[model samples]
Target: MSSLAKQLTGVVANTRKLLDLCGSLQAENDMLKLEVQSLKVAVDTSIDKNKQLEEKVKALTVARSLDEVEVGEAGINEKILDTKQKINDFVREIDKCIELLK
Candidate 1:
């Protein structure tokens, strides 16, 4: 029965090694899950920021069209200044988004 005992001991050692490997894998899986959750939050925030930027662009387009149709020499300078301000604001917002990504 010495050979049988040796076989049992070997089996136990292998089982322990397998259990250790499984535990290690479990820890890695948990870390990956947390990372995925964090990335999802980042993606959602980016989507929201992009939507806001899209709305701002739409507003800018509308303002430009209105200026083209209704602007006169009397108000052209004012309209130009307003459009420039809007453009600058849009640029600042884009810069903020870029900074967030970085």
Candidate 2:
């Protein structure tokens, strides 16, 4: 065989090998992307659960504060005002979170 023909054959073989390697890398990349997507889903689910827990905690805290106000004998009218203020603050915080999510 001619030297030029032999060189061309080597080049073609190398190209095929490179293509095969690229195909393999592409498949691996796709798999990694799928895994990342799954992880993101799980993370989002966890975040939602955390938000629910936080809401529950906030409710419990408000209930506890009301109970304290009752037992402390500070007066019902004052307790109502405090509760209203806390509720307003909570609403503002929720609005901030909504804006951030948007």
Instruction: Write model 1 residue lDDT over 35-98, tens digit each, in one string.
Output: 9999999999999999989887779795765558545665767667767787788799889989
**TM-scores, each model vs. reference:** 0.65, 0.78
What lDDT would candidate 2 get against the real structure? 0.91
The residue ranges of model 2 lying beyond 4 angstroms of the native Cα positions read 71-73, 97-102
- TM-score between model 1 and native: 0.65
Q: Which stretches of model 1 miss by more than 4 angstroms?
A: 71-102
TM-score of 2: 0.78
Clash count (model 1, backbone only): 0
Clashing residue pair totals per candidate (backbone < 3 A): 0, 0
lDDT of 2 by residue, 1-102 (tens): 699999999999999999999999999999999999999999999999999999899889889878877544457778888889989999999899899999
